[model samples]
Target chain A: MKNFEQRLQRLEYLADRIKEPDLPIEEAMKVFEEGMTLSKGLRKELESLQGKVEMITNGPDDQGGPDMVPFQEVKE
Target chain B: MHLKKPHVDAIVIAMGFPAKEKAAADSSPLLTVSELTSLIKGNLEASFPDVTVEGEISNAKLASSGHFYFSLKDENSIIQAVMFKSKLAALGFAPSDGLRVRAHGAISVYAQRGQYQLIVQSLRKAGTGDILAMLEERKRLLASQGYFDAERKKALPRFPGRVAIVTSPTGAAIHDILNVLGRRNSAIDIVILPAPVQGAEAAPAIAKRIEQANRLDIADVIVVCRGGGSLEDLLPFSETVVVKAIAASRIPVISAVGHEIDWALSDFAADLRAPTPSAAAELVAESREVLLRELDQFQAVLESTMRSKLDALGASLEVFSPELVKARFEILSLPIVNRLDDAHEALVNSIKGLLADLDHWIALACSIIETASPQAVLKRGFSIVRRVGKTQAVSASAGQAAASRGGNEIVRSSTGLEPGEHLHISFAEGSALADVREVNE
Candidate 1:
């Protein structure tokens, strides 16, 4: 898990690094591919998180009403 | 008198010389068919400015030399017509029997046949629908092949390096194209490759010039154009040769054939099609003012881009300066020192643990020494005594008595008996060496 997290962080860093102008074109292309992977992974995680929240919100409520607030108001 | 003069009554009834006067008054000249036809021809020419006659084309024959002889007939009337080969070939479509046509010319008599005929200067469909029918199939074929597709059409050069114009040298189209191009972009080179544009050989000549220009790589783009004319006059431009030449050209071809409403095959095949030659030149070459404005914009963009690049480079240089690097190192040094201090504490703890182990070993050594010490031997009732002048032990009782009498004395002292040394005798009560006895060795 820690190794995956480290790899994810490194990929994000590389994505940001490729934004710099002087990067070699070949390396930048590789960075773009990696960035795409990271972006896809992050989107998948976000979608899953959203799905979980949706499931919880739709589950066994006293009534299906707009009266209740969803998850925490803030996250770090 | 009435009966006898019945025959003479007729003579009497008629007045003298009255019959002769009536005959003279009724006198008139007679005319033949040829004379009347000449008169009608003269009259019709004076009466009508131009006449169009609709009829079915029949008895059509083109002579081996260079003349066309055909007849135009309606349901009842038939009239002979003649079109010389030069004009017949220029007609584009062949005139044939049963084809309905409207002939534009004057009515006149051919003296040889003594027949009235139409000397047709031009001919076209009597109705507009036939033209549409003729063009439909071609349009469908070209459309299916994607020749008329907007996506396949090339975007005309924004600024052509050099423009080569293919048009008739003597026509108004060349003048119009040159005038527009000159007004729009005077700096652009305009090379005109003159072609006939309207005769039997026009299509092939135009196609050849296009191929020549393409092979020579003379122009960045080409404009094939001619002035507007009647549909038949524009047919040369619509020929398959011209269309294929346009399609095959490597350089972009702009075709401006006729007026806006007139579309030809060349227009479909061209990379860019304009309504007129002047418009085509305008499309490929921009107005001088628009070009100047674009140049100004490009200059501004170039200056701004270079400035931004330089600024970014300078900013990066400042960020990577040695002083900044040193400052960054100093900022991070404290944490590294703190980490090192933590490591030092760990090492000190380990050293303290080793010292504690050494202290335990020292305590064990002390205990062992206590067990093996001479003081322990003393506690065990073991004693070491020395003779007066020698390290000898007095053990047996008789030996101790004998030593006391002669040369040795028994003593319970740290010293032992020695030769020529005096010693005090000590026993359970007392012992002493009183005399010396010489014993056998």
Candidate 2:
């Protein structure tokens, strides 16, 4: 029932938390499960927007484009 | 008071004059034991620099001044050791009784009580009860130079294109990593940067792998790992060279050496530290089931979201459908429609006006053409007499004089020719050829 943006944010937080070194096993598993849910949601959104997919080159800032790229040969 | 006894013994002493002469020589200006001890202490201080001693700590106490007073003992003997507050602060771990320690400091005698003791400058716990103690020491030393700060830790790529593993190729560590990676995710390209994991070559070889990985740009993230070991076996990870190599790596490094309880200095310095080889592999590549489930869930959510939006828009469209509101729309647009009809009528009227103007212009053009017609000129009794075999009109003008003078010309001249050679005459009624004998004007 979570909105896409909200769910994606939660997933990113879960990813970050689980990525820590000393995270407790139980907490990590919880995060892993939550991250799974969030990741699934995000992936669904990504695939749905596949037709509108534009190659986004991550830079130091948020300046990205949905335009031509050499590596854009990757299929949807 | 002893002269009587001395006099009786003197006779006996007189027999040993040589012994008496030796005694006199030995008794001349001899030093007291205290002075001699002081002289030896001064000389010891002047000769030897500070040295380290490894022994078990006993009778340890922290004084009010924060200086530590402890006695270091071997099995047979013990020596007094005092570490001043300044030096004691540098100790990463707390010092306690019965703990074996390696203390570095100068050996000096207490001048007041005259006891030789080791003045500890620094102390480190020896013999590895907690490997983390030594690791903490090394970690502190390296961390102060910014080796393990969170800011320096690199983030691992979500979907790494290539992963280079710096571990023993023969050991279970690599097998575990490879097995996990293959089982979890086989999409990544892996390169084995095999290196020794024990003995003298281990640290250097591990460092070499890190360097080679960087040089080749072979991987997005490098996993420097090995199996668990004792404190001695794990020393390679604690080496400055290996930790520095991990710190200096161009690619992000994942340290997966030793078991969860066994932490090496490289663990702190690396971009990330996995508890074990298999754990590191799992970190690098999530389980296939998880990824697939994630993808499926994402697909469903995305579909549902997009579908909901579409449905909502469709509902709104149905509520405001043009077909349902056509009568109302027509009524609302009645004024505009009437205006448009009036505009159309005006446009037609304007077009009719344009057509009338075009007709007037055409009639005027026809009248002008009729007035300028050559037949009209002929109706006005102006004949266009033309020459035979030529399209030029015969006229009484000066330019036609040459044709008029020619007697055998295709058209006859109005004046008679006084020539017997040839003559031609032409009028509106007919054309004739005649000969003239006499001159005529």
Per-residue alpha-carbon lDDT of model 2 for B350-397, expressed as tens digits? 999999999999999999999998677667765544332222333334
Candidates in order have lDDT scores of: 0.64, 0.68
Report how far off residue B17 is in candidate 1 (Å): 52
TM-score for chain B of all predictions: 0.43, 0.45
lDDT of 1 at A76: 14
In model 2, what is the error at residue A22, expressed in angstroms? 43
Cα error, residue B100 of model 1, in Å, equals: 19
User: How does residue B281 of candidate 1 score in lDDT?
Assistant: 67
Model 2, residue B111: distance off in Å is: 56
lDDT by residue for model 1 (B170-223), tens? 687777776775565445556666677888988998898788777766577888
TM agreement with the true structure for every prediction = 0.39, 0.41
lDDT of 1 at B275: 92
Tell me how candidate 2 scores on lDDT: 0.68
On DockQ, the leading prediction is 2
Model 1 chain B worst lDDT window (10 residues): B432-441
Q: Which whole-number lDDT from 0 to 100 does residue B299 have in model 2? A: 45
In model 2, which regions exceed 4 Å deviation?
A1-76, B1-126, B129-134, B287-298, B320-322, B330-441
Fraction of true contacts reproduced, model 2?
0.04
